[model samples]
Target: MPALTDKQKRFVAEYLVDLNATQAAIRAGYSAKTAEQQASRLLRNVQVRAAVEQGQQKTAAKLEVTKERIVEELAKIGFSNMLDYMRAGHDGDPYLDFSELTRDQAAALSEVTVEDFKDGRGEDARDVRRVKFKLHDKKGALVDLAKMLGFMVEKHEVTGKDGGPIQTETRTWREVLRQEKKG
Candidate 1:
């Protein structure tokens, strides 16, 4: 393959920014009306594809974005239970001890609020303080992990007019998690 011209190299670099070929072409100085066509032509060029691949490899190496790290982070958020952050005291009231939070639990924290106030008169005054914390997006993380583990399957059932199920499907998220833990 022949070498890429300066603008073509720039287009390849921009393309990796978001994997949007038309936008990359526009950013690389192509006309708005013809950016899409230009991007298609550029993608068909073997040299341009090779340049994009090389740039992607370099970017991945520089950022250290590995699949293992991504899965580990997703698992941390997906498996985290809100109950893990709360403890029941002898009084039977659940209270959160921020100091007792683990690394992943802390990472899962999305919001924290502290309110301290005095209640009643001076003679019967008591300190009333509340600490509230919201964790990261649990459902989103769970869905992402399920997809990564090949568990987010769309099970369609062929039904008669009465809507009776004619087919069944199953996903093994639990089994995959168990295997990961054992291994």
Candidate 2:
């Protein structure tokens, strides 16, 4: 067998990562059916093993350089630290007030029983109410009411000036009532 070039050695190492001879062979540029035989032959050669190891080391070094460059570029773009990136990417509902809770209130909140709390007045205490409505598409066919109204209204769990997640359960509409009156 001839000595493999640097590019050929790198391809072989990538294929060997999963230890599937057929896959390794195909990835190293052999036809799918020939991959198994080619990979087996390559693996058995001492020179090929040495070359593959060298290729893998070079690939790893290149990957490290690429990762460092990406981090450096991100820092230049105002993401000075990894924590800032993580906070911007994943943190949700930044305005929730956890500071006002008493010990019992916090315990109750932990149990998820806040949904049952009601005012002493005669009116319904639920923050959200579900209402169904019909909508028509451009072709005058009835579209899903929930989807249509969903676009118009936003949902919230804890209510303040700032919005939260949409309350899918408790919703109402005056427009649907008006349409009913006209029909």
Best candidate, TM-score: 1
Residue 21 accuracy (lDDT) in model 2: 62
Off by over 4 Å in 1: 18-20, 40-46, 117-127, 153-183
Q: In model 2, which runs have C-alpha deviations exceeding 4 angstroms? A: 5-21, 65-183
Model 2 over residues 33-127: C-alpha lDDT tens digits?
A: 65776677777878877776676678778677554453333323321222321223245622233344444223212122123344555675545
- How many clashes show up in model 1? 0
Candidate 1 per-residue lDDT over residues 1-183, each given as its tens digit: 578999999999899999999999999999988799899989999999999988888988899977778888988887889888888999999998777788988878889999999989978999999899888898999898888888888676678558875655575989866975797
Candidate 2 local distance difference test against the native = 0.50
Error of 2 at 145 (Å): 54
RMSD of 2: 29.8
lDDT of 1 at 64: 97
